[model samples]
Target: MHDPFVPHEMADEAGVHPVTLADLVAQSDIILPHAPATSDAPLMDAGCLATLKRGAVLINAARGALVDGRLPGAGLDVFRQEPPDPSNPLLGMANVFLSDRTAWYP
Candidate 1:
């Protein structure tokens, strides 16, 4: 649980050990970007993905724009464009796993 916007007290109440974004990416074996995608800025872009430890896996149940195709491997459920274009780099990567957005719907 690494969210700078979350107050320390709230984090404590939630029983999550909050850390800085940099630390989270550097230390995590699996990164899950759960933040909402209302902001113009992407939470995780190519530069941020490059900082991830080698062999680290990214699981994006949030917005697809949060991830860059440069990653070695990823599990993606959403994309900037639903049913991404056939030429999307991520769709061609052998290590990338893509699931339909509705896979999670109940």
Candidate 2:
């Protein structure tokens, strides 16, 4: 069985993208982006967010630089800015959860 805590590669043997970042953003109800933070482009942010599945949950545990937006009820161990400003909107939301970056270590 696949390791439950880690994300496996999304390509198949033929090098086809069975599950792409684009695919995840557009279709998934729960998106855990474990992909690299590339300089290629920012995530297709607003356009994709608008089309996200209802009740979508985006946990940006890895690809922080690639995404920027407000998401509901996020349990975040990572953020685009470490120690985000007090004025950040998520900080005021009742459902959002933020953790210090050390929460993952033993």
Candidate 3:
């Protein structure tokens, strides 16, 4: 499946063009639906990491395992484990931006 991470492009453009990982790596920032894997003990496997754009900002407000496996510099509001294990690599990544999941609601 080809998924383009372009900002103004439609989903069809991405899905139809077949953007490879190399293409994405050439760009900056990626917005994902979940967090990277290998966090917490029972690490979930997520393949979206294959689509990650190098130096991209993964936006995960959906599932913690959506972007698992590959390390990303992202804005994470959630994780596979609530109150993510302190040792998660993302915590040490200089580009990561984190927020408590509950901060989004009343």
lDDT of each: 0.79, 0.64, 0.57
Give the TM-score of each candidate: 0.78, 0.64, 0.46
Q: Which parts of model 2 are misplaced by more than 4 Å?
A: 1-20
- How displaced is residue 16 in candidate 3, in Å? 13
What's the candidate order when arranged by decreasing lDDT?
1, 2, 3
Q: What TM-score would you give candidate 2 relative to the actual structure?
A: 0.64
Q: Write the per-residue lDDT of candidate 3 for residues 1-106, one digit (tens) a residue.
A: 2333454356556555445544543453654433234345322234545655555665557766544565645678867777899998778888778888668588
lDDT-superior candidate, 1 or 2: 1
Question: Which digits, one per residue and each the tens of the lDDT, describe model 2 over residues 46-101?
Answer: 66677778788777778556676555456776656677888877778889787777
| lDDT, candidate 1, at 99 | 84
Best-to-worst order by TM-score is 1, 2, 3
| Model 1 / residue 10 / CA error / Å | 2.7
Q: Tens-digit lDDT track for model 1 on 1-106? A: 7877889999999888898787888899987788788776788877787788988877888786666547656677788888899998878888778788676588
Among these predicted structures, which one has the highest lDDT? Answer: 1
Which pairs clash inside model 1?
none
